[model samples]
Target: MKEIRQQKKQPEVIRKRILEQATILVSQKGISGVSIQNIATAVGITKGGVFHHFPNKKNLIEEMFNQIILDLDQTVEYLIKRDQTEYGKFTRAYIHSSFIHQIDGVVSAWSALSMTMITEPTFNKIWMEWLKNRLSQHAETDSHPDLELLRLAADGLWLQSITGVIDDEQCSKLEDDLLNRTYLT
Candidate 1:
């Protein structure tokens, strides 16, 4: 039973490693520069081994996106649940989640890579669909003009931070300001 459990765990471990390496490579080299062979080489696995888990580069990108979305969803859900007020709850969670992903070392790499991925046509669509669904779900509470402005501001701040146009100190202040704005809405 232990041996069988190890066998089951190994594939999952490799798949995760592939996604990690792919994120790093894509962030450093841009989307066009990374390939299945590049990911395999980084993971110290054969091309066929990477292919065994991901049939192509697109599949790998999509899987990476899925993982990112899942993380964001969980973070937002947790933050929303902890909040007592319904007003602007989703927008507050979004701003907090954005800053968390940006500053938190665990997901900082993904922050940079996600900016790149969002530019890709397919990934862009996937991201937009996710945003649309989330917004629709929270329309009753998050549809206010003030909340919408705060959300857009948070997005702009996120873009500025990733592009190096906004320094860490300034970003923190702006993030705090946005969170405070959510309370007013």
Candidate 2:
């Protein structure tokens, strides 16, 4: 009975540690390089312990992606409360929150997972459908052509920033321009 109780508690403890370490590693390095052994070492645990909780790398990746989706959903909620217009909410939330500092490993994990999704048929379908639904929610049919152009520009800037292709200054400038076009102007 005592051994069984300890074993049950051990899995939760190991999983928490693995996730914390994995999040840091993924944010710092991106997903391609993260490994069960590496996460285990980072957490000062054994590979078997990591596997006990995750079973495989795919599960870990999925968990991380799910967390990201949850974070994005929370951000959307915050934006909805702060801004009345759909464009304003999206612009403000995307520009301000998307590029916040995270572990290099976590960022790398996200990048690798994203690349995988690009080629995987099921993931690609789901991602495209999600994007379409999200875009539809904010897209306006009667906006000026210039406003539409600006929205695309903002999206490009956000994508670049998320991929680590743009520096903070450039991202800030893009955010300011997006805010100006979407609200001030």
Which residue pairs in model 1 clash with each other? none
Candidate 2 residue-wise lDDT, 67-131, digit = tens:
65556657655765787665455555544544452444345333433544643334566556654
Off by over 4 Å in 2: 1-17, 23-30, 101-122, 138-152, 158-166
Pick by TM-score: which candidate is best? 1
Residue 88, candidate 1: Cα error in Å is 0.9
Candidate number of the best lDDT: 1
TM-score of each: 0.85, 0.66
